[model samples]
Target: MCTNTKENDMDIYEFYSGRSFDAYRELGAHVKKEVTGKKTVVSGVEFVTYAPNALGVNVIGEFNDWNETVMERCYDGSFFKVFVPEARPGMMYKYKIYHRDGSSMEHCDPYGFGMELRPAFASIIRDMDTYRFHDAKWMKNRSVCQGSPLNIYEVHLGSWRTKPVFDEQGNPLTPEEIAESNRVAESWYTYKEIAPMLAEYVKEQGYNYVEFMPLSEHPSDQSWGYQNTGFFSPTSRYGTADDLKEMIDILHQHNIGTILDFVPVHFALDGYGLARYDGTALYEYPSNDVGYSEWGSMNFIHSKGEVRSFLQSAANYWLSEYHFDGLRMDAISRIIYWMGDESRGVNDRAVDFIRNMNQGLKDRHPSIILCAEDSTDFKGTTKETKYGGLGFDYKWDMGWMNDTLNFFRTLPFVRGEHYHDLTFSMMYNYNERYLLPLSHDEVVHGKATIIQKMAGMYEEKFPQAKALYAYMYAHPGKKLNFMGNEIGQFREWDEKREQDWDLLKYPNHDSFHQYMKALNKIYMKEPALSAWDDDPNGFAWILCGKENDVVYIFQREVNEDKVIVVLNLSGLVYKNYHFNYENGDTMKVLINSDWNKFGGSTKDTEKTIKGVNGDFGFDLPAFSGIYLKPVD
Candidate 1:
């Protein structure tokens, strides 16, 4: 059961359902009401819009009149939004729209808090009081959801694999009909058929989380799941909302966690389900300058009261309804574009939106993990909400990815291959609050395959090539490797074709995949490898030298129980590595990359060595890595 406390520190919870956060931390959640001028107003929310088309708009709610809470008569059309009222806990009502041509919109409830359960009149009446214990249960269950070295498997259901679509009633829906429904997700996948496979495979290979690429309902197919049409509704393409829930449930059962890539930054261009659903701007930006996005997504006017309330509620809804453990808010930096101040500065509006959403979750579920993908210079964007920053568990590390790729793309011995780029990656890896990413963006659309990238450098320089894979496991933060990366897949990832199975038939190429499998196994066994999976304290840098082979890192959590990965980039074996630690002297031989077990020559095997010190060293075989433990 969720804890009952008006004010309490967030608690960690675990269950088959996704993790939730306690909402009490979010004052906005408890907002009986607030007039902007009354407090130290945080950005990300306001009470204004640019509805030039609507003939007349009015604010309606439980406070105005129970049965006739419609505000149509009081509206002047431009932007008629009501601010948060004092002590109006869980206001539930909809806009009474007045259209042009002498027509009064009836049976129209855009922006309804809880809709009617009947057809044509969507039930929007959701009593805030009914959702009790969201934080407590959420916190407790998050404890059950363990964090490990993350290798995200980014998936878009419509195009992730291939499946069928069904109507709300469980009947088959034709492709053409689904297409006409204005839903962007024309692709599909059955949870029963996919989750188990993905879970089992991920666990077998050593990935910790699966980032479901934008599961929220949308209206564009070719645009991918980026354009959200319904923030609350799961796309009807792959399966029903219930099916998506079960899919996550099964993934958890398999000991794997899930990451929901949420897109509150903007709505779909068409704005079918979420856009103008309230007959006015319920979720668009305050104006085009702030709401318009590069991708044509309907920008959420983060500077409005109603939109702010709606987004915060939507964040909680997934946790309350579908059990989403975490959220990866897509393209947050672009949500609010700023013309003044620094070019990279984020609009203050985004700050408030993120803060309220996170606070609400923490109030009800402390165990909830929240991540945002931002490309702007939003300082402290991932700090604690109380610190006046967006309260997020983590943010995508695009800087590291870009730098590492630049280095990986370079041929060994090339001027750019100077340890500078690799060294730069290590320096900037932890620049953000949290990071664990391996998206389809790198492989698809002609970005080149991971194997191909390595082949560019490693094909001729096997030792350096092997170093890339080894360091990924050896790094001291959350890690993200795609599906085929576990075993070497030669070609880039493609939905249209199968992974490079032909390469596996050959001894050398097959060994690369086998080598990757061994790497994952050893990686999972090491605490150092997973320390940065969620928290900020899991990693630290020990050494960064001009020599590529001379770099050293500490997973901070390394202990006697862990499997220490030691690799040498030298072509010839190096003997008697200078020891650094001051621990016991015998080292346990775990496994070696050069061993035939991974399709390599048996160059050398690790022998237990004594250790205990601030610094440690080992004898490494040429072009290989070995796992070990300390012994007396």
Candidate 2:
């Protein structure tokens, strides 16, 4: 028998009916203290799950030696819950559900706050209020990113760093010891240990925010936290839920905001997960035709009200409980179109669900950001819901990323035909709030690293890469780059290994690293470069369509201060490249990618130049770019 019937309430029923956005706090495992006897207070946990189609349900866990029938359901047939005085925090548990066909299955809690590490799938009861955060200053000063320098460094936590092997005398181990230690990939740093290190690195790199590539609990390491089975639980591979909270606290103390890459479109297909709860398709679609996702996972049935409440509650739990600054929703293109295919026509049910969910989250936390990685030409993605839009704060500019990368991949002799790729982004720049991203998607699956994507031999890629980055920073919109891009790391990202840290020992790579630092510092310091990114007046083209020399020049202006950017894509140097510069009386070289410091050959040219009748000319280096600031 269950411990008590007096604690039964209508909250779980409301949750099942899709009315509770905070269902995470009401359903699942909630710890409560009850006065069982005089002068006696017993602290226990209440387990609630919605399994309306099940013949019977039982709460099984370590507290009862995996007993199957110790608990009882409530008065309502739609929900089942039990209060166990013996169920305390840190105990493992799962629901033993009996089907109408006389069969039974054990499934993890849909709203479990914690879960055991892989190879052990039981849910762990966690007290969410145990950790006290000290990020009041950051929280108080935080604002939604609008016309601010929002440069994000996206990282996969495990691959960011690994544990180092050491000898008995406390000296660093030899390569032989390292190879043996790293053979099985067993060494990993806990969240509490890696927090300060990651925060320090991000600050030194001059990024204000860090976007994690999904930290939720998943069974397989290869999925990189994308195939999540525990949406509400931080993966135990790092540490406990409190450990994750501590990590966030440390980053907040360093004044570095955290953005979580959230996956809401689909879930892992593990049997113990949400695939077939209550011996039926409770959280996902039943038919395989419309049920499965492109990644071979079950798709969420958004038309169901209960599923909508469940997904939104999980989203809110991250911001409210973990203190996350923002959410970069993954695979939003799937939510806009059926099976993520534009040819499949728009999915009306999923579209409505997105609008409703986004509006609800906005109502609760207006200062938190919601970014969508959608490639479709879906208008009003960044518009407010009241104005008949999807209500996202920012949308990934996939078209711009593809076009720019393809242009760089084209050889100089043929780049003239694709010159429009560089200028085409501005044609629809104002249609939505966009974020220019060179994300993890670009560097994986044989796509090659950012530097390797340049159209040249191994050594020639460096100069063009520097030119590409200069153009990206000078271009409009916020910025996001994957972890290894800044250091000119040539290897594609792998989930199992740390980034190539030793590459910095090389002179060319180290110089490229310093160039990135200078660019980031300049981006943060110059208001003319980032202050009015969304405003059309912030950018003006000084020169375009010079197909012969493959040269382009543009200016980013704010409050009358301007920085002119010039790019020469051809391999041939021009002794004199002339362009019309408005107010060119005091033109000075702000940054020259062709300077000797950044692994370039052009060092004899003068850093300062003067204009005659608003016309300025300078020695344009081959396969390089420069930023010129008009001092007047």
Candidate 3:
């Protein structure tokens, strides 16, 4: 190792000091033009990495025939850099780190912009600045999702669409050495291939945003990109990084926003990963008790300044580099408490790190969203940082998801006892900005799909599911449903398989799908349903605390426009259920969840309810929900 050089060591100190949130661009392998002489210029790649404990570091790649002698460590003892004039984009590379104890290990660049596919771990040099994005209009008009309609369609990019194996080398398949390339569901579609299809489908279903389950590089297919390795690199399984940008471009062109699921708490325990890098627990905690996560991965040590810089830089890089509209941060409760166990008490260091990062990201990009999937009632999780809060734009309403799902799981006769589960959300609805999520977690690993979670037999579940979605869409918060939930998919989500697209052939499923589409369109179109979501003046419970009928009604009001939503969770119809309406307000049925088109008993009754002295009546259908709007 050499002594510290004034040139490279200056910014190196700032990176370790933790102020460099944009360290991804400064620390990674970047393409730069160097002047060899007064008139001569050379274009090459500059490789830099941080391994303070290593005795020496060298760059080995295709450019040097995998030889370590070509590029030596710079004068900075904690940092290494080498400029290769011959190195160009698409050249695979790795850093050979020699420990103080004479042990050497080859590791991928921590800040590399691109990575090779699994079974082969190496970072590739790719220039990110050249690609031109044509989303100027989308970027200019984008705003924070405080009072806007945000219906997100959560999708696992690889399994969202599996086409016949067209490009074998580029496809994400199960067996790496399988002889036969052609089979049923042979390969997962790349980001570019699926972008148009996903955009069209999401738009048709009335979703404004598509939240993809993580796109970062991971070795295991089963991890579904959650156990990430390359934070900056969009996984090679879905084509190059440029391809992902193009995909987002197409989505933005269609007026659809893109959100990437980010896992900042932990990382995979792969040998080539951040685990034991530089022959020490640099990124993770030194002890396994705190270091090892529940998912068999290593938890990031948020206390360390360098680690904080790395994680925060990774978060910023995705938004700035890829033009992502937002990040749905996964498992944020773990960051607040030790291993996500509230009993272990709050991790103050980690909590502070989260606040600082969120505030910093907000300062840099005011319009982008930072949503936390926190189950804890951590006060100020969604409050702005200036008010001593965690400073998230939105928080996943896990309480609402749990209570609603559990209520639906009960038999209709017993549902009256659990009716409070349906009404419990409003108690804390104003605490923080919330988004009701029927996420992928609710549909996998022995937890049945949303449709299957409903109580009763096959035939009985469809109507209930239809009513459930009606309630979800009609509820106050923004909405996010998993990939196959719209079509009422029965099977648990599998990473290897695509959604049950063929299920649309069945009348019940098709009708349920159509119902969701209609409901979503209405949710987006109706100002009463969407606008002023965060304001308490927008929502109110009309019918509650009724034990016998298991019926509920709510009013979503915006400005002068108001929508009355009625829900019947029981199997028996109630004739002439009386309710009050404002005088001179012309009320009509906007959407009947029990209509025949939705595989329900009721017909489309555009019946006008003429109110006398602020009173009205309606015959409620069994296992149905309806929306009544005040028309002219």
lDDT of each: 0.54, 0.86, 0.86
Give the Cα RMSD of candidate 3: 3.3
Instruction: For model 3, name the residue pairs that clash.
Output: none
Off by over 4 Å in 1: 1-98, 101-141, 144-152, 158-187, 271-282, 335-344, 415-417, 425-432, 455-466, 490-510, 532-543, 546-584, 589-591, 603-623
Model 3, global lDDT: 0.86
- Candidate 2 lDDT over residue span 1-632, tens digit each: 23334544646555655656787876799888656667534488888887888888888998888886344665456678777878888999998888999998898898999999886799999988779999999988887778778889999888788776566687765434665564324446889999999999989888989999888889888888888899998998889999999999999999899999998899999988888888889889989998888787889998888898898898899999999998999999899999988999988888888888889888888888889999999888999999989989999999999999999999989898888999999999999988999999999999999999999898889999999999899999889999999999999987766788889999889989988888887888778888788899999988988987889999898887778889998888998778886654668887888888888887736578788878877788888888888876
Q: Candidate 1, residues 1-632: lDDT per residue as tens digits? A: 12223443222221001132322122122222224776633221112222345666444445556343222221233334334342143343444455565444443232223332212232133223333222333334554233555556666554444445677897766545655674324344566567776778667766666778776655454555677655555554555545666678777766566777777677665522555544555566556765566676667766665466556656776766666677778777665345323566756665666677677776776766687786565666677778777777677777766766666566444522455654565554555564645566777777876656653454433334456677665654455565565445556665433344556676667677666766767666766566444444554444445264543433334333444556554445666565444355556766676776665556434345555553455555655666555554
Alpha-carbon deviation at 80 in model 3, angstroms: 0.5
Cα lDDT, model 2, residue 353? 82
Error of 3 at 44 (Å): 1.8
